[model samples]
Target chain A: MGQTTAEKIFAAHLRDEPFPGTKVIDIDRVLCHEITTPVAIADLEARGKDRVFDNTKIKAVIDHVTPAKDSKTALQAKMLRDWAHRHDIKDFFDVGRNGVCHAIFPEKGYIRPGFTVIMGDSHTCTHGAFGAFAAGIGTTDLEVGMLKGVCAFREPKTIRINLNGKLPAGVYAKDAILFVIGQIGVNGATDRVIEFHGSVVEAMSMESRMTLCNMAIEAGGTSGICQPDAVTVDYLWPFISGEFASKKAALTEYGKWCADADAAYEKVLDFDMSQIGPQVTYGYKPDCVKPVAEMVGTPVDQVYIGSCTNGRLEDLRIAAKILKGKKIVDSVRGIVSPATPQVFQDALKEGIIDIFMQAGFCVTNPTCGACLGMSNGVLSDGEVCASTTNRNFAGRMGKGGMVHLMSPATAAATALAGSIALAKP
Target chain B: MKKIFGGPVLCLDRSDINTDEIIPAKYLTEVTKEALKPYILEDLSLDGFDAKGAPLKNAQVIVTRGNFGCGSSREHAPWVFEVNNIHTIIAESYARIFRQNMFNCGMLAIELPKAQIDTLVDMAKGGALVVSVDLPAQRISATADGREESFSFELSPFDKALVEAGGWVEFADARY
Candidate 1:
């Protein structure tokens, strides 16, 4: 009877009586966003349900299509805002206040270590940096989670992605994740729990760890998590209330929740971080990745830098460093949207904003915008664009548009040159 | 009204074909289903473009490694693949959500044993290989090698009806 990290977290957060691992365990946290919530609200209205299960526990945000570019998006935002007001969802983070859901969540204390957080977006695993069991759900299940504060899930078998040694400089967590995806292919870890550990992980910052966990969905994992430590405590301390004693007690309770030393796992993958380099996805899938040096010489018509995947402040700083003196290629269309207002402000204070503007790029406000093909920087027919955002499915940025997924560094380099570089070295 | 899916298997050897690769995050909009067809298999093909004057045309069956359809719970995923003529998929595994989406959309995701996948990939080197997916028997057979394989699946009443109707949208339309 061995329990894994996720199993332990799930047990701690079980809403009702616990059962065997075979049963579909109901989740504790239910989060939603603009694109997915409107329909859920409509479903709730149709069902004649007036109130949500628990206003305090449930969360909603306006990350998608906010600063509404057009009437449709503005209308969509309004609809989401109105729904949140109507439901009295206390944890709702609206536009101006909202950043990327994954980044802003832990900051606001909506996600605590050892808690189970479920959202309607794929990168819910970003909360896993705090040792929480965070996973994504669909619209219908989101509707159910809104009403019941629970969504059903089975216990996933675990896979240990162990890293050794230090990552090479400029080879960030995004590259590490892309490298793993390249090795395992997409869907390599479906219905599986992914727990990242090792010397490399321990050496990485909490933010970097979040970036890795954020893309666990690409591996078909239910949830991905890193164990909590001092960095986790420091990251979370800002959002807690009451005296330090109360918060420390809660944190201690969380510390005890990590998977016991003898917990079972189905598979283990060991990789040396020293072998990884700056990588980018050449084609539509995140797993369609290659080393930066090897990926050069591909032509590009557009370049974008934004998304929940790599749209953080650090991502912007990295891109800004690359683009400061270099001008965007005249033939290429470059769009830079920050992940959040906080990121946007940080970039502004750091002069990253000026560099981007000087480079002849369009810097849109924070939103899910181009990441989901709704707004800014969509591709025209037969168009090819390199983007920092995750995914490159055709018509993803725009109909008839060809997408190449990459890191902000790669995206910036592509924008400057108007072609995928053969080598940034 | 039991339906049959007949299409040659254009086997894909790689594993873990994520949903983001199936349909990128950018295309989650567009209320209409018809708009998604061109993007099908856009990443896997060499042209580095979606369908429309591409080399690989009318590819029906896809063979891949485990956990096909990972990332983001987008229903539009299976809809795009189903409309694109990807009738049957032989994979070593599948993501839970993506597998459920495929089933709901009436696509047969046959999980073959890994050893058989190797033989199937070899057979597909020259051209398309014919793989028969018998839903009633829950068995997948590769005609080139003449090997029968078993797949683990649980077809809900809703999915069974959709598969019986030939496709999901058709079943959805029929219900209306």
Candidate 2:
């Protein structure tokens, strides 16, 4: 029986056959963020299992409500900081040094092909872009991963999503993924790994691939993965140069993680990317998508472009290209937070920050605060935001606020128009 | 752990009842489960649904439509329900992580067919529906306005074991 990439990775990491069709797999990396880890740390402390299995294997960050939105949030960060220090986990990232967990982890080369990674945040699936089997787990599973270095799962199954044809002008990985989610509905890929394949995926940059994989959870997928090819090698080349003999050698080694030509899949979906347009989500669901042209002139009070999904340097450059030499409408408030300090620094060197500021967008520090309605740029009640972040769930950005998920280009265009608008090709 | 449990049913009557609706993200900073109690479904906007009012305050079980508890991998969603003593959730389907989170917390997240969910929703609309879950038998029965109906469901052996041991932590403590 041929095995998919996810199956291959699972088999390689298998530590126990706990039950029929269930495997206890050794995890290579355990990602932790303040919002969820504090509870796990507290539980571990209560159980007298306060030690981490491997401190180096764990990466901790305080990004969610950075700068301590309140005393409670501050305490959450404090608990995680004290725990990380006590455990001697040196990869701990604090305020100013931290970015969104998904972005910063990969940026720092913590993920690699064929690794099994688990985190308590849903967007942890973002790391699957590196050909790893990464999934978002709950606190109990996270604690187990931290303590025993293992997590249990059902035998792996896969849904192959083949994005074929060339993307049309102004269309991007965000649109292709949004279109896929709209077809699958929210629970379309439940309990299954989505292996993104085909020429479209082959051409996407790492940033775009991360954006695609990050929303796998939105479609109820365990993870979204891409084959580790030359693109993957190039993305990690700088950090991994000393580890591999050469880029070609690294590519050949990572190539082992790719699915077999005849890999079996539970379901296969084919999408024609050329048919997609710049996409925007309406209503309160990420899957409630429509071509931005269909939503032209729909009023928006705010525009936000940042998150693990679309806050990378490429996303910033794309939005900056649209906003250059232009000013956002007075009725709209625009904000952009680069995904990491590196991305922010790179954008600053490229004058992307100047473009955003001149265009009236507030450039905030790297933090995931506003996306979940914690702080930074939270929307007021009844406000509508055209955002480049994933998830349009009701009140996701604030109480009674509406979030319309779009690509950074669409978000920049909407900011200029003070309404939902498509970016000019 | 008890194999059979039942209580007054509170039907959300909507698909895609996400975690953000169950427990908004702003409250995630609170480390204790009890701190999440008052805000359960605070941001949810369904017709005639008051998150803090009698309908939710008095209910001990939740019946909703497809894709219940979608969005975000926040265990706070399940913790909020656990704090409120609403231990069972019946739906047509669930978001993957949220479903697992429920099981991890030693709570019941039952998945019925769409047809069975329709019957439950209709029964719930009849003003007072009481649901009884028999875990050993894998059966769920609903009674409303003198009418009694039952449906059969299945849980994987692993999930069954986890629930039997009262969550993953307990299950792991014995083995790991």
lDDT of 2 by residue, B27-64 (tens): 99899878888898898879999876897888889988
Q: Residues A282-369, candidate 1, lDDT per residue (tens digit)? A: 6666678788778687789988888777888888888888888879889998898887788888889999999999998999877777
What DockQ would you assign to candidate 1?
Answer: 0.22
Tens digits of per-residue lDDT for model 2, A26-116? 9999999999999999999988889899999999999998889789999999999999999999999998899999999999999999999
List model 1's recovered fraction of native interface contacts, to 2 decimals: 0.36
DockQ of every predicted complex: 0.22, 0.81
Q: For each candidate, how many residue pairs have backbone atoms clashing (under 3 Å)?
A: 8, 0
Q: Is the docking of candidate 1 incorrect, acceptable, medium or high quality?
A: incorrect
| CA deviation > 4 Å runs, candidate 1 | A15-21, A69-75, A241-243, A246-251, A422-425, B1-68, B77-92, B101-176
Error of 2 at B162 (Å): 0.8
Candidate 2 local lDDT, residue A315:
95
